[model samples]
Target: MQRPNVVLIMTDQQRWDTLGCYGNEVIQTPNLDWLASEGTVFDSAYSPSPSCIPARACLLTGMDPWNTGILGMGRGGERHMGIGFEHTLPGELAKAGYHTQGVGKMHFYPQRSLNGFHHTVLDESGREEDPRFTSDYKQWFERNKTGEYGMTDHGIGWNSWMARPYHAPEFLHPTNWTVNESLKFLKQRDPSKPFFLKTSFARPHSPYDALPYFFELYMQKNLPKAQVGEWAAMHDVPKDASSTDAWRGVRSDEDIRQARAGYYGSINHIDHQIGRLLSYLKGSGLMNNTVVIFTSDHGDMLGDHHLWRKTYAYEGSAHIPLIVKLPKSMGRTVERTDAPVLLQDIMPTVMEAVGLDIPQTVDGKSVIGAMKGRSAEARDFIHGEHSTCYSEEQEMQYVTDGRVKYIWFPRIGTEQLFDLSSDPYELTDLAQRPEHREQLAAWRQRLISVLEPRSAGMTDGDRLVSQAGKPFVKSPHYAERLARFPLPF
Candidate 1:
C-alpha cells in the first residue's frame, strides 16, 4: 500500500470551543465543523505548554518541554542549543522518504529560517519589539516605526484605538504571505511522492488583525462581556497563569463584550482561510490520498476567567481542538475509543499512519489503531507543564484524568485541583480544602513519579545548551524584573 500524504493544519492561540461544533454559536467555523464530522474529534486534546514556542517544540519532537529545553518564548535559551532541524517532524519525515514543507508561523525561532523542511515560507514582519507580541508594549513604542496607518495609543482609556480595526483575516495580515507561498508550493509540488505539509495560520493571536469583512461580521452581533465580578475573585490565581497585558485594566461590561466579539471575529477569519485550503486540496485531487490533522498549538483566554492569553491551567487555555481525517476505508468516519490524549501523540500517530517505525526517542504512542476504529488502550492521564516566561519565577505542573485536573505551582506553593466533571470552568480551587487533600496528594505523588524518572539530569533552573555549545539567553528584562518583584513562593 502507498503511504498517505500528511497535511497538518495548525493555528496559533485557538481555543477548543471556538468552533460551531464545539457548542459555540457565536462563531461560524463551517470548515472545521465539517472536518470534525468527517473525522474523529478528540474533544479533550491539550498542549504540554500553553506558550507558542514550547508547545510547538513539544509537538514536533514528541517530547516534553523540559526534555526539549524549549522552555520560553521566541528565539532564546535552549533554542540556540543544537536541537535545531534535526529532531523536527520534517526532519524525521525526510528520512522516511517524504517531501516535507511548512508555511506560515512555526515559531521555531532564529526567524523560522532554520529547520529541516524542504521548503519554508515565512510571512512574519514588523519590528521585533512590537508590543502586541509581548507583555511590555512600551518597550516596542517607537515613533518612527510605522506601518499601514492604523490606530495609535490612547492614554489610560479602556475602549480606545487599540480595539479598533477589530477584524483582520490571517491571509491578509503580513503572515498571510506565508499562506500564499504554501498555496504556491501545493500547486507546484511533485505529485508522485507522498508529502508532509504543515500549513500554519497565525491570527486570532494578537493585534487582532483581520480583514474588514470578518470585522463586519461580528459587528452585526452583540458580543458577550467578561464577568468582572467573577474575574476579580480570581486574584489569588498563581501569577504565572497565562501572561498577557490585555486584561490589566478594569473593563466595563460593554468593553468585555466587544473584546470577546472581536476575538470571535478573529477565529472566524482563520476558519475561512482553512476552508479555502481544504477546498484547494479537494479540487487538486489530493484529498483522497491524504491524512489531514487540524489542531492548534494552544488556546487563548478570551475573557475566560478574565484572562486574555495562554499560560493558565484552565480548560480554556489547556484544552484544544483535535480532529484527524484519514482516507475513508469504506466511506465511513470511524469513532475512536473515548480516552484522554496529549499533543505528544501526534508524532507517533503520523509515523504509524505512514507505516514507519516509532522512534524510541519519541515519547508519544501511536493512535493509528484508534483512528482506524480498532479498540486499543488509551492514555490514562495527560501531563502538562509551564515554567516562568521571560523569567524563571513560577513553575507549574499538571496531570489530568479527563475528569479531574491536578495542578502544582511550586514557586508559589499553591496547588489547584478541579473536578472537571463537575466544574469545567475551574472557578473553585479545591487544593487547600481539607476534604480534597487526599486526592490532591495522590495526584501530586503521581505527578512526581512520572516526572522524576523522565528528568534524568534536568533541573528546575537549568539552561538548555545548544548543539553548537552555546547557552540560551534567558530574557534579560524578565530576570531583572523578577529580582525587583519577588513573589512569596
Candidate 2:
C-alpha cells in the first residue's frame, strides 16, 4: 500500500467543547463535526502542558515537556527561549521521505526556526518580539491589503472580554491566510511523495475578533451561561479590576457574555475556513490518499471558574478535541475512543499511520490501535504541568485517567481532586473530603512517580515534598541548544 499523506489541523486556545461532534450544541462547526463523524474521535485527549510553547513543543517533538524545557511560555526574561528537540515529528517524517510543510503558529524561538518542517509559513499572531523573522502573514497583509488595517484594530485586548466583528475583509484575516498558504503548499507540493501538512490556526486564542457575520451570529443568539462554582471565589475579580487585565477576573456578567460570544465566533470562523481545505482536498481527488487529524495546542477558559486563559488543570485548559480520519481506502470507519491520549501521541500515531518507524526517543504511544477499533487502552492516565506564565500562582501539575483528575499547585501547596465522571464541570473540590482521602493519597503517589524523577522536589518517592533536590534536567537540548536561539528581545 502506498503511504498516506497527513494533514494535521490545529487551533490555538480552542476548547474541546467548541465543535459540534464534541457535544457543543451552540457553536457552528459543521465541517469539523463532519470530520469527527468520519474519523475516530478520542474523547479524552489532552495536552501534556496546557500552554502555547510547551504544549506545541510536546506536539513537535513527541517528548515530555520536562525534557523539552518549555515548561511554560518562557516569557518575561526568566527564560528567553525554549528547548529545541532534535528528533521532531516533521524532521523524522522528512527524514523518512515525506515532504512536510507547516502553516500558521509554529511558536518556536527565533520564529524562523524550521524546527522540523521542510517549509513553514508563519502567522504567529501579534508576536513582534522575535526580531529575527518576519511573519509571512504580516507581509501578505501588507502586500494585498496595503497594510491598511491591522487585525487588532478593533481594540480587544489579547486576553479580554471585549468583543467585536473583524474590521476588514474576511479574506485578509490571519485565520484564512493560514489555510490559504497551507492550500498553496498542497497545490504545489511534489506528487512523487506523500506530504505532511500542518494547517495550524492561531485564532480563537484571542483578540477574539471574529469576522463581522460570525460576531453578529453569536451576538444575536443566547449562548450557555458561564459556570461559576462555590470554590471559584478565589478567582473573582474586584469590580475595579482593569478591563484589559488578562489575569483579573471578569467582574461583569455582561462582560463574560461578550467574551464567550467572541470566543465562539472565532471558532465558527475557523471551522468555516477548515471547510475550505476539505473542499479543496475532495475536489482535487486527493482525499483518497490522505489522513486528516484535528486538534489544538491548548484551550481557553472563556470565563469558566472566573478564569479566562489556559494553564490550569481544569477541563477547559487540559482537555482538547482530537479527531483522526482515515481515507476510505484504509477501510476505517467512524469510531470513538475514551482512552486518554496526549498531544505528543500524534507524532507516533502519524508515524505509524504512514508505516514509518516510531523512534524510540518518542515517549508517546501510538493511538493507532484505538483508531483501528481495538478496545485496549492507549494509556492508564496522562500527566501534565505548566509553570507560572503570567501569574505566580499558575504553576501546577496534574494527572488524570478521564474518570478523575488531580491537580497540585506547587507554589501554594494546594491540591484539588475532581471526579470528572460525576462533576464534569469541576464544581466541587474533592481533595479535602474525608471520603476521598485514600483516593487522593493514591493519586499523590502517582504524582510522586511522575515528578520525583524530574528533580522538582515537589514529591519524594513515597510522598509530597515541600523543598528539595538539584536540577535533574540532563538533556543537552534544553540549555545547550537554547543558546543557539537566544531570546529575540
Instruction: Identify the candidate with maximal lDDT.
Output: 2
lDDT of each: 0.65, 0.81
Q: Which candidate comes out best when scored by TM-score? A: 2
**Candidate 2 lDDT over residue span 118-214, tens digit each:** 8889887878666556789988887888456776678777666577788878889898899889889988998888899999898898888888888
lDDT of 1: 0.65
Candidate 2: residue 370 lDDT (0-100)? 84
TM-scores for every candidate against the unseen true structure: 0.80, 0.94
C-alpha lDDT (0 to 100) for residue 72 of candidate 1:
52
What is the per-residue lDDT of model 1 for residues 127-242, given as tens digits with 9 covering 90 to 100? Answer: 23223342111122232234433222212122121334532233335334445666777888877668999988766666554456666677677664443323235443445332
TM-score computed on alpha carbons, candidate 1: 0.80
